[model samples]
Target: MMKVEPASPQYFRSSSYSSCHDLFYEPDCPKKAKGPMLCVKQPSCSESNFDCSSIFHLQEAQDPSPSMSFKQAVVLVVAVEKLKKQVQTPIHFISDEDLYDLFLNIFEPEPIECETVELLDQPEKRYIYRNQTIEYSIRDIDKKCFLLQKPLGSPRLTAVHLQGPDAKKEVKINMAFYMCPGNPTQEAVVLGIAGENLYLCCTGESPPVLTLETVDKNVLGSMSSSELQPFIFFKSNSGSTCRFESATFPSWYISTSLAENERVKVSQLGQTAFTEFNTSRS
Candidate 1:
């Protein structure tokens, strides 16, 4: 037997360095040419009872799963406690597959809730309560009436006489107020020429122009509330009269010219233009 000596005291300057013996190599031990590895002499197979060819196998066999690891033991203990609590009757035993599933479930991410998924996929509920087909006549403060005129084969609004010879005929062709859906306050409305497919549209120019553009009422059935915003007007009632301001163009109201028989248009100034109109259901 060879004895190994401790390293020089110069190697340990502070008390932080503890003394430890190198078991792999000794200064006076004989080393085999096995690259940079330190070699140690082994006893014969007969004396040590170790087959050199199967040493690793024998070592593994000696410690073949003597006990479960910390994590495995913890999972087993938890699984047993959960089983004891859940089972109405005494648990006879638990299968290996059940334990594996429980172990996987402990670490696996939970599935998304059904209610949350349904909310994400469900279509938004629309609240459209003003009744779609209600018609009304828009009469200006000056007693001038709003009547549709198609002189150049294009339908446009014109302020006309209320009690003239053609008064009854013009009043019969009153404007229809299609209240826009999804507006809780009932302020937004779509003005369409009664018995015609023409709707009042605001042009997207520098200064928006009001024009009676032809729209398919059938196609409007398929449109969303946001898509109908161009033709929608915000109706604000004051006393006996109400103002129809353009929804697309804020602060702009539907107005007519000062002179009678002139085309009804849009104006930003309430003082200069005739904006207030008294409505009557037809």
Candidate 2:
């Protein structure tokens, strides 16, 4: 003879609760799914496989899970860890917002692929590279503030998170410096060019503005007039201008750009660099 078991009774029935939660929908049994929905991090690892499995408890996989999978959880943890290490002054980061959305959905028990992988060992440097390179720390707030300096060059975000607290911030990132293309260069030493009129081009900011100072008579007499190229020098390069692609100010900064101070020091035995330039005719 066949027999049917009696149904058990519970105080909270699934049929009574209803709300606007998207998670409340039951994929398997809409009639039986009542009570609070399971969170991605809270899923039982022992009971299920795939997505949330990595972050979920390994021991929990032996039992059924209310929410989350292994793979999904791993992806979330990895992303969160990177953010914490990189915390700094606020800037517009679209990627950070996208990652937040991804975290919420990672636990649907679907397999997830982590964009970052834990390195076996720490790297020697956190390099931000492009046509040129600069070292940066992902964990540093101060460093980020310095990157906003003008003459803007378009930059990119390419950094990889490694494992450990002391672990290096990232592997290699491509750099993008803002470019004004046509701006006066600053802080250049006028190295006078050879010619009848004598054209002077600065080693630093091209077409450097200069202050004219007279070379001492004793020193002037020792060298040929052509080599001395006698002209007065100034401590401050006066008004000046140049194209952005120059010998100095080659990269980008996160902070405000400051005009560096120029100094004038003369030597008895050594020839001083002229900060200012003036023509013999003028």
> Which candidate number has the best TM-score?
1
Which candidate number would show the highest lDDT if scored against the true structure?
1
Clashes of 1: 0
C-alpha lDDT values of all predictions = 0.60, 0.27
Q: How many angstroms is residue 29 displaced in model 1 relative to the true structure, after the best TM-score fit?
A: 86
| TM-score of every candidate relative to the true structure | 0.50, 0.13
Each prediction's total of clashing residue pairs, residues at least 3 apart in sequence or on different chains, is 0, 43
* Residues 1-282, model 2: lDDT tens digits: 111111222121122212322322222213232345433322343333312223222122232433444544554355344333433346776797798789877855568787977788743221111132223222111111111111254222221223565233332211222212232222212222111122121132433322223334345335432243213111122354111112222331111112221221121212232212211211
Model 1 Cα lDDT, one tens digit per residue, 1-282:
111112222211111211121211223222222223311113332433211221110011233434535554354344334333433356578899989999898888678866533355634324242554567777788878877778889777889876757776563232334554445565666777777888888767668899988879777656675567677787888999988888778888899777888888888864587998888887
Candidate 2: regions farther than 4 A off: 1-181, 184-272, 278-282
